[model samples]
Target: MHRRRRTAVVVTSALLLSVPLLAACGNEARPGAAAVVGGERIEVGAVQSKVKAVRVAQERSPQAEQLVKDSGQLTRAKLYDLIVARVVEKAAEDAGVSVTRKEVQTGRAQLVGQAGGEEQLAAMYLQQRGIAPGQLEDVVRRDVLVGKLAEAIGATNGQEGQQKLNAAFSAAAATLDIDVNPRFGTWSDQDLALGEYKAPWITQVTQSQGAPVSGA
Candidate 1:
């Protein structure tokens, strides 16, 4: 009878020790993933690579210290951009919107003209948007795609149109089933945002062009 009691106590200790281990396993759904969107992993290495590119560009800029200081949340920002890129792609696909190579080139040219030169354009984006020079083309393409997607959905030139645009993006985001790693931040479908950073270029470009969400 004394031996039987010892065995029961041993079994209970083993079960108690496993509780924490099981909880840890539950938290790591995909090891080394920053997030999982549409059942695909956004690996930590991919996010770090983009962040490294931005840092490299910033280091070469005249406002290197200020740029780096301002983007202290650079990891989260880059991750946000990565997640939004996928969201924009899905939204555009659903809206039957497509951006061509010529459109991207034209968009870049227009921006360059506005900023005075290609170097100035790079500086402007890096300083204002935390976007690296190497990532500029992707940014331009996404911007153009957003514009086309807005038009395709008949997102008119006002608040109503803005609401439509948000709806389209929100729907796409919801379908993606975005799951962000706790170390970064959370995802919000309704806001079409990652944590506090809402969609940037979309709102900025729309408001600047005076085409949609004028007050926004």
Candidate 2:
């Protein structure tokens, strides 16, 4: 039997909290920022700090070290995240889905509640993870905006519009042409052949194992 190993690109909640770090690192060393996205400048310090935080969290896992060693995989994943964020932000702006301060506060409260109450969750997230209180609100607000934009783009489910929404999403994904860098984690031609041809699960697994994990 072929077993397909799902290669999950793990981005933690802590990274979401460290978005400000993206601007801080950049402005510290030089006069200007490192990267700009959707007219917003990204700070090198912020990106570095966020990456460091992610590494710190991953240190607990054996896979973390190996993943770090894979520089291509790391870079590709980071770029992918940035691109997605920019795309979502642009889409939200186009749709005029504004994220407000009040909405952010509400979202933060809801998150805290979901994490099992404010005090305990705050201590764990703020004290332990070094995430500022305001950062939580920003993350929540961004997520809300993204959701609203997705709904506007017909990416949400409704009884009457389910099929239409599905078709729209499919067309959008096709148009996006999201090509994964082969040096990073990507499905190979062999893997695609197996998956597309509807080969037995076991056959797909065996074929995938023989294929190279990293590209040239």
Clash count, one per candidate: 0, 11
For candidate 1, give the lDDT of residue 132. Answer: 81
- Candidate of highest TM-score: 1
Task: Report how far residue 215 has shifted in candidate 2, in Å.
Answer: 28
Candidate 2 lDDT at 15 equals: 18
Highest lDDT scorer: 1
TM-score of 2: 0.43
Per-residue lDDT of candidate 1, residues 1-216 (tens digit): 121111100000000010010111124658878888888888888888887898999999988999777777777667777887888899989978888898778667767776778998888777777778888888777776776777678674566867887788789989999998766657788876665554432452333331211111
In angstroms, the error of model 2 at 135 is 5.5
Runs of candidate 2 exceeding 4 Å displacement? 1-46, 56-76, 118-135, 158-216
Pairs in steric clash, model 1: none
Worst 10 residues of 1 by lDDT: 8-17
